[model samples]
Target: MFTSRMFAAGAAGFALAAMGPAGTAHALHSDTFAADNAESAAVVSAQIADTGSLDGDCTGTAIAPHWVLTARHCIEPFPTPGGSVRLGQGDQQRRVQVDHWEAAPAGDIALLHTVEDMGLASYPTVSDTVPGLGAARLYGWSPDGSGKTTKLPVAEGEITELLDMSLFEGKQMINVDTHNGGKTQPGDSGGPLFVDGKVVGTLSASLGDDKDGMSDVAAYAVVAEQYDWVMETISGGGQGADAGTPGRGDLNAAWLVGGGGGVLVAIGASVVVLRGRGKSDAG
Candidate 1:
């Protein structure tokens, strides 16, 4: 639980910019039919409970039985009141209340614990290494394209750069060129970027606007860099406000600098765990 003081401390870092209502990212030039796979099963929709809203506020992944991985900014203000996640796809979608959440003391990542076990047989595991340059897949729920009336939107793209300090200060991330497949728009935030069949990054931000037909550059938080923090949070069931790691204030500071003192993007967090992808330079 992030205390008021902690939240205030974190908020102080963003004094340069005013926090606004949360928004989601989307995917363009994507195929909704290609979402039929194992990875899509693990993907969940993050939404506000009792809102009666039809779509998810953001996207997330089930990393474990009852644990979900998402960008901290997606649940801005931390632990949204009645925050819940929707599992399954299309007509099978169901919403579950979040028991609690654990924000990494450093990165833009956060863990949501469901009130009950998700009972998932298989889910997308995190990748240990980060690929320098290669093809990757993007998954998310958006109100655009077929996503508006369908399930998940899957996009195929290529990793172009590994950024360190160029965007988020002291944070590691990767840039994917979705020019071939499509660009990530609102509502696609917090979604997973897959290399092979494992998750290597979580949607963060895009270099240029996708609507204006600029560059289809998408940035993601490097998962391997925060492996220890993620596992520990889930294993320990979150370190209450008094215990565990403390310093989201630092993350907030870096985030402000990373976003160029503008409205904070809905997604922009790191994932953990390592499977394929290759040796990660994230340290």
Candidate 2:
């Protein structure tokens, strides 16, 4: 279901492995974040870490004052005990502590309960129905090829496919085409896909055919499919019982890569390489 290699961005080694943009046209749009709550609302740059070191970066969305939504792979295997989310940018940019975490039972979705209110003017809500196949947009925090993080990049994507389940994790997914003209590179995992101004999915993985790791299509975990889990997890209250302090643990995660052969099911994101001393081997 994937190309020879599926490189994920955001993680330390992931950005280099995933290469750069594939299309000629730049898909960045500043107006996408111009709405109220703008800066902190997007839940930019989540630096997940344990007691050892910083794991990696992932994009997230502040759905509530104390809750941020992201891909489970960003904090899986061993839950992140402590981390910070970048709110606003430039002079206004500030890091807020993430005190707790909760992962969905069956999907790539997860929640990061922050210690402070995100201060979003208009928090984006999850959609109820399936996203109609058409125009859509995606937002994430990625580097600008120089290892320097870019201002939240918003790309114009098209919802081309809706599947009963994902090729990686068996969870419901949506295929967004950003190829030929615009594409998602590294550091985009856990990003949010906006369809009709509502959050429909979270960026899970990308599929490409080239060698640079530039992806023509992106797979998103359907938010509507995981709506109940997200709401219940958040409503259940403090930390969902699994949240705990950061501890020392080894992170050896794997991503599925395929080409013209058999398929493989990945229970985590397509790229889960940790960002510490060096790149860890795929589990």
Candidate 3:
């Protein structure tokens, strides 16, 4: 199964231990997000914290006015379906009470449900299939080598091949290159990758934690393969909706931590560290 390490092993000190990209950690690389892009429909950014300090965690997107999509491992140490999603920035910013959080039974993809509308712009999934060999653009809110933040930074590269790593068994993964410094770093977990004008993948993991935040390689879960589960979850046709929210309690009480809201509770990083490569059966 796609585990937490698959999403943030670099940041949490797992794969490529010394060579991670999350701030001398693991995989967020490239430049700062353009200021104009923040106003683009539904592209949201978030930072995770706790009662003690700001952990500066993952990033995600609004799939619906009440639903957010991110890497399953991003919610480390915290129980899903209970944390709050701090969406947007500046005057347009707001928070979505994540009442429902469910990881796909298999892949690194996960969904967050809000009790109320987030009123953000959501990216459309491509109607046609994503070509095997094509260029892709990575986006995220993680700070870069220059320590830039408050904007969405993007990196351009190609979706070279399908991943053949063990962690991705039975999972459709796209091996995106981090060549020339393009990458997904610390705090960039769960960010989206765009192809053409639609989202084709979700940021997963990278091979190093170099100071630039760009790793030797990066991996993403193909959005096309994950579309079915995403749709089912959004329409209430998925599993875990009625599972009831547990952990730190409801959003209201759980959010008030450290000083303000957004503190995550009990989310831990996974220990598995496996390499991803090309597969013979690119399905």
Our model 3 lands, by Cα RMSD against the true structure, at 11.5
Highest TM-score: which candidate?
A: 1
TM-score of each: 0.71, 0.69, 0.65
Candidate 2 Cα errors over 4 Å, as ranges: 1-40, 50-56, 144-147, 167-170, 237-283
lDDT of 2 at 236: 53
Q: Give per-candidate clash totals.
A: 14, 3, 33
- What tens digits encode model 2's per-residue C-alpha lDDT throughout 156-217? 78898875555234356788886324455434567788876678887776654344444567
* Per-model CA lDDT versus the true structure: 0.54, 0.54, 0.48
Shift of residue 25 alpha carbon in model 3, Å: 4.7
Q: Ten consecutive residues with minimal summed lDDT in candidate 1?
A: 1-10
Q: If both were scored by lDDT, which would come out higher, candidate 2 or candidate 3?
A: 2
> What tens-digit string does per-residue lDDT give for candidate 1 at 252-271?
21211111011232223321
The 10 consecutive residues of candidate 2 with the worst lDDT sum are 251-260
- Candidate 2 Cα deviation (angstroms), residue 139: 0.8
